[model samples]
Target: MSYEMKPLEFISVKFSIGLLLGISCGWLFPIPQELAILLSTICLVITSLFFLFENYRKGIYFGIAAFLSFISLGIVAITLAQPKLSAHHYSRDYNQDNGFWILELREVLKPTNFNRRYIFQVHALNDSARSGLILGSIQKEDKISDLKVDNHLLYYGKVHPISPPLNPYQFAYDSYMESKGVYDQIYLNPENSIQLKTTGKSLKGWAAQIQLHIKKELSSTPLGVKEQGVLRAILLGQRNDLDPEVYRSYKDAGAVHILAVSGLHIGILLLIIRFFLKPLMSSYFGRSTSMIVTLLILWVYALFTGVSPSVVRAVAMFSFITYALYLKRPTSAINILALSFLAILLIQPKFLFQVGFQLSYAAVFTIGWIYPLLIRFWRPRNRFIKRLWKLFAVSLSAQLGVLPLCLYYFHQFPGAFLVSSMLIIPFLGILLGLGILLVLLASLKSLPDSLALVYNQMIRTMNELIGYIASQENFIIRQIPMDRPGLVLLSVIIILLVLSLQKKKFVYLCFLGIAIAGFQVWNLYLLHQNRQKNEVMILHQVASTAILYQNGDVLYVMTNDSMRIKTLVENFELNRRIQSTRSIPVPNSFYLGQDQWILLDSSGILPPVRKNIKGLILTQSPRIHLGRILEQSCPDRIIADGSNYADDIRRWRRSCQIYGIPFYSTAEMGALSLGQL
Candidate 1:
């Protein structure tokens, strides 16, 4: 029997899309609270009016009312998701101020390469009571274990807003943190910061404590650090201990999701649980009890994983499925998927902006909708062949779903994803099953050394296999140009094509073909637009100076660093889709159209900066008297690149200030993008 979708299957999906769009609008073009309130009220009134018209059965007005209802719903969602804190909630005086403040540690962050970070709530700021999420970083010390979530701390710190990207095409670290409700950061001295013994008696705190204990136990095991890290990631969703090289291996091998506890991980765990409770599966009451036990375990697992976006989505999906079975209610995968997504967004609307959240839903939802179609296209006689085909179908479906997003965000494609998934997933699933068992036994202090040894060696073997796969450069395609518009257009095409395939309609196929042609034309048009650009950019890089001059699709780069300038040029090339970048040595002067770029170096002498020399590029910490240079030859602006000393830049800034010459600091203002000369 074909599984027919329910009538309201798309309702939640529709509302969720609108809700996200509303959130995006509010975030991108934030309005004042008063203005937002007014807009919400206006939408509400219009929606009410439309409802009245529909009630009167006024001549196909129901269609208009339905459309207006979605609009009003989106606006209302925006109003609800708006941050309660005002634009200036944090006192301006606290921007650079450092003082003794009490902070309640709320969440433990995965330690990065630099330091151990945490999300702390401000209890008292310099003796004044205040509230907000603060990104707290503790210097890595031997006593890192003492810093636990829920422990109140008194510390001296400086408040700083998260800095934007220092380079082009880089990840927006500030926006990513903001989406998770973090605004300010505090750099705390781990030794001096006094941790208060008093801890909050909360579920999150308890979960964290348990997690810490498991981590502590894992640290004592005989397993190697890399093995331990992989096991921890697969078992507990903690990957801070993972080596950078190992992480890269997994990413390139297309197995990074296995390290993150998402739908796949949870599904595997549920299967393991069901297997363990096989004796109870024969009876009704026993099955119900086992189902309840499975749900509790899933939630506990979610908590263990820090209740992250992926964890919450996975658990939510499993909850709907498990309960549907228990209640003997009809369940549609698409409807369940929609319901879970809508539920999560309603609670935390900002998750809509998260990449993990998008990927998790997209992958699972696509498998739900597309796998059946792919499975039916081919039939295998043997049961094992059938199972393998199902796996292939699922992988292909998910890959197709997330392909656009992957390209847009990561700018890479895993050509070996199919081979890797087919060859490694079954083994990885079994390994994870064993890993979960070991973690529990290890936590209980009853793990066997022999078992640990075998597990460790197996993990080593798996890592080697993944590394070998990644080493095959042919399978890892990088540097795909996919920006915002490209992502949207590709997604639309995917959706329409999928629909066409399901319906098998000639009109839909024709529309799909037209869309494909239109998208290709749009890409070519964009390339043409970029081909006419002529400009220069002073990039900000610590201890390095790189200048990019773009003429049409071709680029010219000048840098003083002896090292390869591939990274810098690659970032620019991918973002701008440049045709070629040529690195040149620092020249005496460069010309762009009729304008001139005069260079200032370590000579400590001011050259004759004439009227035609309209720009000054400062590098190598020149000791020249900038005030005197302004009098001798006044350029339109003095551009300071990152190669100069900070002290020198400060002095130059002051000199420019006195002479009324505009000093553009790439360090402060990000990469300087100048218009066509």
Candidate 2:
């Protein structure tokens, strides 16, 4: 096989790369919005002039101008996306400590164990107007007021910053929320807050109404709770009602994408639509009408699915494909993919950081790129065998493309993905087609119970199959560690290897080998760093106090709540590649290197020997006199874990402030390393 390409062929690809790089740079080092705008304008003007001057357009100056323009455009896009840049953003002037906030509920997020979470748009802080998104957590209890999207909320409370992870290598939810333009969170009690009525409506609110209607209609059908949840996710991209166990099963079986209305679902639906309109393609007007109808349905579905990045991407990409097919023109798949990628980023630059957005594009591109190559390797004579081979190729390609990201973000891989994919892909089309018809019928209150039963049974069977695959514990690999550099190196290796095979170039093979070597070296570096770690961390667990001491590759945990901390400890150990972990009872005192620690529990009894007390830890709501303790020990710092009472901690903080001593609260500052403290 041979391939040749001109330098100017992938213009979109080049610009996309430049835009991506610019967005990354802008995120890492944010600039003033005005400066971003000025830079973008200057670069765009220069590029325009270079293009207008035909003589100058042929030289490197034009190239530099164009590159700068793309980069600046990306910077401007991200800058403009920042809510804080807006004059009305709540954080700029809203009083956090004391204020009556008027908030409009924007979206309902999945509920946590104790709270129903929501994204609220700030309307006013007392008399001052405000804007920007804030996270609202209302306690889940009986008689809680029903709050819908776009409903106004009035509350008197302090807005607190989102808490960071309390353990090393744990998820950074604070960063995640910030990326979504939500910085602060508020805790609401029924007594302290009230829902206000709103006359205005938003597109999201309209979608919510439709979703609520669908939910109500589905409830009237024969579909079970889990079945209804899956149907909603497939048709509307709403997963809030999905059963946890069912969701876990799908996740473990690597068929979770079936529940997400991404490219696969959209692609299947597109094929179904095209199939029904096949006879119309015989005439020119019929073809045009079919194309128009297909596009309208696809876009309406995208809107119905909440217009998530993945859905929008799929719709936009296939929209181009549909138009190209309508015109009978040869269009490069990569170019269309890049065009959509560029368009989405130009509108919502923050989406670049979203896991779903990244995974969706990666899977689609790899399938387009690698599936053909893999299918060519096996030419099965039988029709059934050939179709199965093609499905396997696609499954393999997508998995390979997203492997690094999966490891980096989720740290797990389903070894049974192939089996599950084989079972699901061939049937997914029928499932989606039937599911969509049932949804439309149900919405109109015209669905027959018999048809509902069939759809429900199909969903139940699929769920059971996925659950069976997930139950094979030996095939599920968990806690696999991957870092950013490793992800990059692995991606590079995959790309180089593919290029080597496709182009039959020894140079590409040499680069592939180097990439693999670099990956190994990076792994070694990480292992070396982990082996050199030696420190003690006081982990913050609600209603419990725990201490972790690490020496080389071994971890020693001191806490009575072993069962409670099992997952946390396992995640920490796996992330750091610890060789061993030992759990022990919580001791009254411990020593690590030069640091001496004393622990006081509910008994409030302090050790008699107070000299050389490096740190004093209060736990289990100790009732000791903090001022007296400070006078006697005057330790370097006072540490309180989550087990301590809030009121006691506040009093102790005041004492520390008066005495000019450092105070560390695990509840506020997250887990503390004694040495760092």
Report the C-alpha lDDT of model 2 over 296-405, residue by residue, as the tens digit.
Answer: 99998887777666788778878877877788765566666778888889998999999988998899778777877887778999999898898899999999989889
Error of 1 at 332 (Å): 1.5
lDDT at 312 for candidate 2?
83
Summing lDDT over every window of 10 consecutive residues in candidate 2, give the lowest-scoring window: 1-10
Clash count in backbone of candidate 2: 0
Residue 248 lDDT (model 1):
93
Candidate 1 C-alpha error for residue 80, in Å: 4.1
Global CA lDDT of candidate 1, please?
0.78
Per-residue lDDT of model 1, residues 1-677, tens digit only? 13344324465666555556666676777666676667767765665676676564454554444444554445445545544344433443365756877888888777776688898877777777766678988678646564676788887867888889877776788888888778778777755588787744677788777888888897788889999988878877778788889999888988788788888888888878878888987886887898889899899888876666678778888887777666666666777777777677667777787888889888987888788888778999999999999989999999989999999888899888887788777886689788878889999999999999999999999889888888889989998888788898888889788888787899889888987987898889888888888888778877777778888889988888736456778877887779787878867677777777788888876555555468788888887878877777768889888878989889989989888888988888878887785
Segments of candidate 2 deviating more than 4 angstroms? 1-8, 95-97, 125-129, 190-192, 607-610, 658-660
What's model 1's lDDT at 358? 87
TM-score (C-alpha) between model 2 and the true structure:
0.95
